[model samples]
Target: MGPTDTTHTTPLPVVLAGARGHGSWHLANIRRLQDQGVVRLAGVCELHPLDETELAAFAAEPPEQSADFGSLLDSTGARAAVICTPIQTHAELALTAAARGVHLLLEKPPAATLTDFERILTGVRDAKIACQVGFQSFGSHAVPAVRALVRTGAIGTVRGYGAAGAWVRDDAYYRRAPWAGRRRIGDTDVVDGVLTNPLAHAVATALELAGSGAAHDIASIETELFRAHDIEADDTSCVRLTTTSGLPVTAAVTLCAEQAGEPYVIVHGDRGRITFWYKQDRVLVQRAGHGPEETVHGRTDLLENLVAHLTHGTALLAPPHRTGAFMRVVEAVRNAPEPAALPSGAWHTAPALTGDGTRRVVRGIDAAVAAAADTLRLFSELGVPWALPTEVSSP
Candidate 1:
């Protein structure tokens, strides 16, 4: 968003698509790296151009802003692009960038459907371009550290992997975007549910810890989805998957938490268990014959990692293929019947913690989510009163 630093080696020309909303974060990050002589903010793609005031924070001189993404990339000679657009548009925009041989840092929930995921994946492969999916947790050093502890039997005989995300969102959250909390926007799938959009890192990182994060590594999936909010998507949901090696990985998440807190993934083992807070790259271990230990690990920012990959040939942290198993979960949710709306008796409205508009909170959901992860059980299996039977999928 600022002038390119050409005092040293030329910075990689980078275009940012959807330069508002979450794209704002990408814009600021580009400016940070731009100041450090890593990447230049070459162009910005937005539906409506940012006003002078809106663009004032980072853009010393406004980068080329245009609604036409492909033309902007071409005009700016972009070497890479960061896409933070709606979930449904990822494939088309990614392929457009790939068509011009631009590398990419595409945002999470790469596409609404696995078909589109494979389509874009194949195109990027055919182009031989580096495409990084924005699952930033995968960039954390703690991931490998947890695996190392497991391998060393610090947790001893991995029993299962469980992740829990309990977050709170106000009613305004769904109103912020046309596709927010939506399953499908007409025939085009949006799939903006709790597990797919907001807390997706929990699911992806859990599968990664289970060492089952590829399509072929996952054998089956079971999902129990429920909505406390009056949206077309689920705000409370849990998914359990069996790896090809017979490991169970489960994630239970909710946007209707009574009290917001950090989400965590736990490695359950026969001897003891390890807990990881992926966002913070922090881990805690309690194993047999050892007192509890806590550690804070380093993390590579995905965008910076992508830049390093292009300029220095560093390995991409979250290549599209590594997210295939998560996409499989998304595909299962897409094909499953609409999430059941919770009965009136099941949830109640409460004042938002931020004191804005109220958000629906499912009664006792915080415990339910934690229980599902701790036990690797579905909500129904936990005897939750309103939970419906899970829909299971096998490939």
Candidate 2:
């Protein structure tokens, strides 16, 4: 079908895959957009039927629900699908949808490996359907503004880029699903770690700010992964990616934090720096001979972006091709040795923010993360006492 078939006058038919957990966010957004007459929620693919309470939210008219993705897409005649299934299932589900000539809003950490990512990329290309990878933060209006500044030399000669995110995830988080905190489940790679999953926006947005979202733009990646919790994957990690352009982008993030805070990316330059708190769509611009300029930006909804592309030839943001570099980082994490557990002296169990629970908090992760971003050093190379340097690189 073409834009003429999906004109603004006609609401695009879209289906939701995996409509529980984080998929609920898509449900709410779809319903909200549905009210505006831009799109319609045609069906849902879930392992089990949604309960009465869950079904009530779609009160406008119940959407078709089924366990089989292919059947759901065929029956609904949906033109697009949003895949928020587990990390390991992304490529499989995406290819399934693409085969049906369905566009996609695939969730972040698009696939567990670069090979899987490329497979999904090739499938979408061959199908000739739009696929918007869900790096929602890139939908922020501030992102383009920041990029324009870098392109026009508003940030001066760019030296490097860095992003920092320190957040708390309780033990219950891992138990929520079988795949949580796992690098590999059986033979399939999950790679669901702090860097690839929860704080992934930080990593992807940093690469965007550095103008290195394409896989070819990445020259090498050096990673120091560590875990403070008992999970299989790293909960706290740092990465230094040197782009083909010779610019470096560093990302330091933790699921175990002493104090939880917003995640942000910093654009470092000789003149000054630009700090973007991506979650809040906030920006801080500091340049030579100018007062600090800050603004909270509005965001473009990715779902609307997809529909606009189909209906009005609007540019698709966060497509799979733009996420190749981020996938390289995921591939590196997947192939890296099992993360080293932090020494007892380096961590402590803090009383949970809620009643009668506990969470792991690295003693000095906050400062160390800042130091790594500021100095372009990995935790081990930065001289943290309890840290031992273990670096893995990918060409």
lDDT of each: 0.89, 0.89
Lowest-sum lDDT 10-residue window in model 1: 1-10
Cα RMSD of all models vs. native, in order, equals: 2.9, 2.3
Global lDDT of model 1? 0.89
Model 2 lDDT per residue over 1-395, tens place: 43212346878899999888999999898988887787999999999978778878787589999999999999999999999999999999999999989999999889998888989999999999999999999889999899888888887999999899999888878888999999888999999999999999999999987778999999999988999889899999999999998988999999888899999999999998999999999999999999999989988889988998887788887888789999989989988989999999889988888867788889989888888878777888888876676788878
Candidate 1 residue spans exceeding 4 A from truth: 1-8
lDDT of 1 by residue, 86-198 (tens): 99999999999999999999999999999999999899999999999999999899998999999888877998999999999999999999999999988999999999999
Give lDDT for model 2: 0.89
User: Weakest 10 consecutive residues, lDDT, candidate 2?
Assistant: 1-10
Residue-level error in angstroms, candidate 2, position 126:
1.0
How does candidate 1 fare on TM-score? 0.96
List the candidates' TM-scores in order.
Answer: 0.96, 0.97
Clashes of 1: 0
